[model samples]
Target: MKFFLTKSYKLFWVLIPLVFMYGLFNKEHSLMVNIHATYFVINHLDFAGLIVIFFGLFGLAYWLMDIFNKKLISWMTAYHVFISIFGLLILLVFYDEVENLEIDYAFKQTLILLMLITAGVTVAVQLLFPINLIVSFLRKKKH
Candidate 1:
């Protein structure tokens, strides 16, 4: 259990999955489609909101790549957490425009907020929990 909380393990299971989920959401939202159709360009808020979402998705992909390459060391995880927070902040900053989309905006906002919170919580757990207990225990030879 504790071994799973280590930087490498957490990077694989937690951070990677979170970033993948972010990418999934970004694709599902079809932000590019909205922009190309001009639905997001009609207003300043919408344009800015769409831009933020794109940046967030970009950051998420970058982070995921880092994890996939086994490059997310402990310090890197800290950076990744900040990036995730920034992504969340971008969404929060544009909440008003996001809430105005044609779909059930309220539901969308709630889902995004929940995902952001869960990502944050997972990072916290990865950092705070005993990460290498299992590995350490296994390394101890029996008498």
Candidate 2:
């Protein structure tokens, strides 16, 4: 119910190394994260590899919120974290070696569509961070 900046950022910081390590040691060896403009390509639709960049941004966001001494809106932070973790889990559970394996065409298309939608939602959620930062910078600090 109540999420704080410390919890929000710590969640991401803890995930960063795990994601980096996963991307590093992944057997597919095809996980390419182009954080260049913030896009990822994995085999076919391998998306979990992007978690490193995603989580790092979150950590940075939370840290910035703290630096600005802004009080986090608990529900907002909780929803953001929940959506992200849900998206991540969906990719990890169903997308492994998907391109290599011969699956049904309809199923593949549906899955791809689902993945894309989820990714879009996740990215959209990140907009909250910069907005949060700007608002925090502008408004008076909370007690």
Candidate 3:
């Protein structure tokens, strides 16, 4: 249990798979979506969501490459960059649809809360995983 919680655990590699599965199994009534119709609506940002899933798959491939070639990690940064770029592009293309979204006040609040919590968890996981990698590298050098 402690090992799983620490920055040194290989379990950190689970991030990519989790991201992939989250995207693949994304649901209409998912806890992640406060508005059930958000993705189903015409001109909605479904393609952007698909891009995010592809980025996750790429991240997993990047990790596998890193296992064989350590330099790949230094060359390829976070996979979220791809997702962020495509997400912004999609938002730009669907600006009117997004702006005209009719989510209720309570649903909007819930969405905001969920977004905050997810952001916090993502940050913590990112921080912890890097610490694990750094500590491992330093220990190797010291030895």
Candidate 4:
């Protein structure tokens, strides 16, 4: 339980609000987020709200996987990767249909863009630890 409140988890909690603020101030829509103002961001997504949600979810996943395998972090990464891939597949298959929808065009587009970003970030996070280890090992051999 205490482990779940570490810096890494806090950092993720921070991202939800940073995203919301970005959405609010981004007049040009350059940030390109999918969050519905009335449905998602305004109600369910705040700093405290997201922290509780992620903390509970991660803690549950971590402990459940820890029971069978000790590699909780690896499993978490794998889980994120799997979900991100699923999101990408949905986006790819339904993109044309979504784009052609008559109503709420901007909202739909923003949602698709958000899905792309989530997929990208999840992949990057999963890869980063392994990539860093490889880079560090190569550097040590060179020295």
Q: Evaluated with TM-score, which candidate comes out highest?
A: 2
TM-score, prediction 3? 0.32
Error of 3 at 91 (Å): 12
Q: How many residue pairs clash in each candidate?
A: 0, 0, 0, 0
Against the true structure, what is each candidate's TM-score? 0.27, 0.70, 0.32, 0.32
Pick by TM-score: 1 or 4, better one: 4
Range of the 10 consecutive residues with the lowest summed lDDT in candidate 3: 3-12
Question: How do the residues 79-127 of candidate 1 rate in per-residue lDDT, one tens digit apiece?
Answer: 4444444544454344444555577867886765765565466445444
Greater-TM-score candidate between 2 and 4: 2
What lDDT would candidate 1 get against the real structure?
0.43
- 88-141 per-residue lDDT for model 4 (tens digits): 334333443455567787897686677667657755654544553344345523
The order by descending lDDT is 2, 4, 1, 3
On the 0 to 100 scale, the lDDT of residue 50 in model 3 is 49
The C-alpha lDDT values of all candidates are 0.43, 0.65, 0.41, 0.43
Would you list the clashing residue pairs of candidate 4? none
Q: RMSD for each model, in Å, please?
A: 12.0, 5.2, 10.4, 12.6
Residue pairs in candidate 1 whose N, alpha carbon or C atoms collide under 3 angstroms? none
RMSD of 3: 10.4
